[model samples]
Target: MSSQPYRLYYDRMTSAFVPHVMLEEMGVDYELVHIDTGVDAHETEEFRAINPNMLIPTLGLPDGRTFGENGAQLVMLGDLHPESGMVPRIGDEDRPAFLQWLFAIATTGHTTIRRYSYPEEYSTRYDAQDSVSEAAYRQLTRFYSVLDGVISGEPWFLPRGFGPLDIYTILILIPFEGDALADILDTRPSLARLHAATHARPTVERLWNFYFGADA
Candidate 1:
């Protein structure tokens, strides 16, 4: 592959930020094209041609092929460039746990938050939706707590470094602003250390400013 064989179509804000963060960590050069997701720009025919789903973080390969789903992207990126150190290669023993924790963020962490943010879409009864959202919040809290425990107990989830596990999991949760998540992690010095290190990394810091900037 050339230095940058793919272009990352993404929005600086929203869920796309996660992969944006990951791609920066990958250490490989990439062509980055940022777009506003909910705006008409991303909905234009040109953009839709790449991702009919109209989602951000759609990765386009060199051969005019493209794919979505951030989880799948992480796995593929891992296999294609293990030296990036952002993920474990396919046959690595850590792959299972790496995938498990990454998926947990999608199935458990993000799913729980969904109920809170869009209760009405998921339920007909407004009252029922409230209860569901509440339950989801509690579950999310617990899951973050579990992650806190895991990170607290180790230097890294993989016993290696911040690969796909941290990339897929932590980035999803960071979008939650004004939460006690950081406070809870503070209780776990080890986890806090890891989080701090992640934030301190050059790539992550660049992404933080690029993706989270007020102008972004």
Candidate 2:
């Protein structure tokens, strides 16, 4: 391991939470650099130098390299800390399922949540925002249902146990907690069980308090 700690640029409640939990779970030394998205800190030229895409959850490595995107970061971290078992090794029975769920949650699930959360980004018309959000929400529900059915293991997505797929799934779901989440959980008991189990972890509980407050 490098002598310097990894640096994570984040904004509260963003996709940054995924890697935040992963880093904590891995027990690696890392520093949190908060970028206030409310003030558009992520859009500034200075921040762009770190990550051209201006996306949060940008990770700075000890070797002076930085990268963004939650899915890519999760893969890198898992490879770096194979002992954590966040990613299954080649030829492992769970490896195929692991890759499938990881990308499914990261791309399809993440995109749907993003569309629902920020509908204005999908459309410029003020009157159309609600429609965009509603459409996204409906799609998200279907996606979640599919995931709920695929989960055949106890407390985790795969038979091998807890890994990045659970973290990615829950991170996207967190934003819906006080809103329409209960409705989603009401129908998908499997997903609800996974949510509860993920949050029940000591690391997850502590990080939840830090990012969403103790009451959250």
Candidate 3:
């Protein structure tokens, strides 16, 4: 690894939270570059030069390569710092299940949440927004059901113990609020346990307060 610290472009409560937690867990030297999404900082040309996608959780590697996408960032960081044990090694039997959950969360889980949170982005018809959100909620519920069933480990998603998978899963769940969050947790015992376990970490608690405020 390069001696230079990794740079993480972040915005509070975004997918950046996953990598933020991962970096802390790895105990790697890193710098945080705050991108205030409230002001559209991520849309600026300056930020775009580093990440063409104009996304948060853009990682600036020690070698100067910058890329967006939190899932890829987690994979890269895990592979780069195997000593952290954040991911199962390529030949490890656990590696397959780890990748399965990681990619599922990154693609399906993330996409479904986006639809639920911002139905307008999926359609221009104002009247259609409710239906879109409702459909997304149904899909999300189903997704959580499947996720809840496969958690064979105690207080974590995999038997190997806490790692990137737990971080990524909790990231998707954080956006849910009020009855929505309650509904998910109340119905899924495993997911509720996982959520509690992830939040119980000191790193996660501190970062959550840092991003969403102590009262949150």
Candidate 4:
């Protein structure tokens, strides 16, 4: 129950999914403001004033403060609502490893997904876009493999149970699934199971429907 009014600026079907789900799970009062990336809404001065980087998932607080970057935002939310147990307490056994994977998925998987999705943004050479995308997909698969290896099949990333880190894993994995990448996910049993479990969560399903229509 934060006294500050919160707003999430996001694009449809984007990386903002994670924080959206997190906010729903936390049951906080907030507003969802959609921006059309295709129309360069992110690059506009008004939006840039909220987030200099013009990134989706820029969180606005009542005090006129804004926060961006998915990793920092997730950690902040978890810290703010310790009763939710989305993050471990300082002396908890899983705290160290939880933090490690949180950053791992954020830095490695998130970055690779961005490259795979928009190679043209990362590469100036039009001819190299295909090669860059291919390499990024390969790297993304490898990052998934790393995650698969770590799962002990307990339905959550950490031994303690569900946490914010699991949400991070789901966000990073969502873009790479349900098409040609299905085979890649099928090969990793643990990760696949983890994905299934994460997606089945009530909060995720509710938010998915909200953000992408009921048909989604």
Taken over the whole model, the C-alpha lDDT of each candidate is 0.70, 0.86, 0.88, 0.81
- Shift of residue 176 alpha carbon in model 2, Å: 2.8
Q: Considering lDDT, where higher is better, how would the candidates rank from best to worst? A: 3, 2, 4, 1
lDDT of 3 at 48: 90
**TM-score per candidate:** 0.83, 0.92, 0.95, 0.89
Local accuracy of candidate 1 as per-residue lDDT tens digits, 108-152: 876676676778878988779888778777787678778766652
For all the candidates, what are their Cα RMSDs to the real structure?
Answer: 2.7, 1.9, 1.5, 2.2
Q: If ranked by TM-score, best first, what sequence of candidates would result?
A: 3, 2, 4, 1
Steric clashes per prediction: 0, 0, 0, 0
Comparing 2 and 4 on lDDT, the stronger one: 2
- Against the true structure, candidate 3 has what lDDT? 0.88
- Model 1 ranges with Cα > 4 A deviation: 1-4, 124-129, 175-179, 187-190
TM-score of 3: 0.95
Q: Which candidate is the best by lDDT?
A: 3
For TM-score, candidate 2 versus 4, the one ahead is: 2
Candidate 1 TM-score to native: 0.83
**Per-residue C-alpha lDDT of model 3 across residues 1-216, encoded as one tens digit per residue:** 578999999887677888889999999999999898889999999999999999887999999899988778989999999988879989998999988989999898998999988999999999999999899888988989999999877779999899988888887786687896898899899989999999999998898787777543
